[model samples]
Target: MRKFQDYRDSVHFYGRIWTAAAILMLLLAPAAICVRYNAWPAASAVLKGLLGVAPIFWTTGIIEVLTYAPMLGTGGTYLGFVTGNLSALKVPCALNAMSGAKVEADSEEGEVVSTIAIATSSIVTTVIIAIGVLLLNRLTPVLENPVLDPAFDNILPALFGALGVVYIAKNPKIAAAPMLFMAALFLLVPGLSGAVGVLVPVGALIAIGVSRVLYKKGVI
Candidate 1:
């Protein structure tokens, strides 16, 4: 217990320091760009931009924290959030790693595995992105080719489809209701497709509720 408490304390301490530094660097970059280019937007214009996206971004950030923290553990949460791209990359990578390692998330072993997975993912992603940028001229035509556009467009669905099959196979009782609900929702209101981010919490809530009911009924 003491060891775990100490680990948590250490994580909180260093996490705060690193997170603060990252925020500072992010803010500084734009400020430096504005200063160097003599192109600072008006305060009102900045406010307008913030107003337009802040609500959605803030909501998504809060939802991600709630949704991912348990699966990621403290160290993983700290590093993953700092690195960004949680849904598209880090979260899935950590989950897959934990699954393969047969570690229950939120356990000590899970924390270690998740952290390792996220760290490796972040490093690999950075290297790949760097290489892609360096080869942008040569790769642009291939990447932007119309013949390959459909593959690019379906990448997210393809990724989640494979992941969904794995997880659903493991916990079909818990997954079934939410999957059906989301599928029905999209079919009924195709227009909401653009707002999937906002719907994440809704699906989570539905799944939780369904799972709770199933548990009470001893169905799963």
Candidate 2:
């Protein structure tokens, strides 16, 4: 009984309640109209893409989130160049079931069109976030040590910090050169943006090589 009380005290139940309340509110709200009208076939295509990818991503946390956004933007933009809307290109976001935001209607080239905002772009995102936090706080403790949260939370920072050090130590002459190279490569390389799953490390290595070459010649 004392252990249960201690767990409750440490876990912050109001936060969970607040989260559930927020998600409940979002569930009760009206979403953008086109989503309501669009055939499930359209929405299903989008949902499959997003849901399939989201779970694989859940464990990656924030860095993956930050990196994937730009990468997918680039990839999706290029993908738009081919396969067309049958690829569901215009509404890349319809892929997720959780998003409920609306897009306005517009006429283009004698066509009327509308888009479903990405699930991430929905006004209800805050509720999803709250629910996620609530679930994490409520559930993780049952399977793991509570203190492990604070400790494991620091892993990303530490790993990136170490990476930064290795980067600097490996190439001290042109600190910004590798960064600029990566940025440029990500931008200029055809179909390379969303490919960051492949591009980042490749770009980083190419950047390091170029920076080293430039530094050796004192041109950087």
What TM-score goes with each of the models?
0.93, 0.27
Q: Taking the candidates one at a time, how many backbone clashes does each contain? A: 0, 3
Q: Write the per-residue lDDT of candidate 2 for residues 128-204, one digit (tens) a residue.
A: 65776789878667537886777676754565465557546756665666666666776788565444444444545
Question: In candidate 2, where is summed lDDT lowest over 10 consecutive residues?
Answer: 107-116
* Candidate 1 lDDT over residue span 77-167, tens digit each: 9999988899878989999999999998978888889999999999999999999999999999998999999998997899899999999
Best by lDDT: 1
Query: With candidate 2 superimposed using the best TM-score fit, by how many Å does residue 98's alpha carbon deviate from the native?
Result: 44
Q: Residue 200 lDDT in model 1?
A: 76
What is the C-alpha local distance difference test score of candidate 2? Answer: 0.45
Best by TM-score: 1
The positional error of residue 150 in candidate 2, measured at the CA in angstroms, is 2.6
Weakest 10 consecutive residues of candidate 1 by summed lDDT = 1-10
Report the backbone clash tally of model 2: 3
Cα RMSD, model 1? 1.7
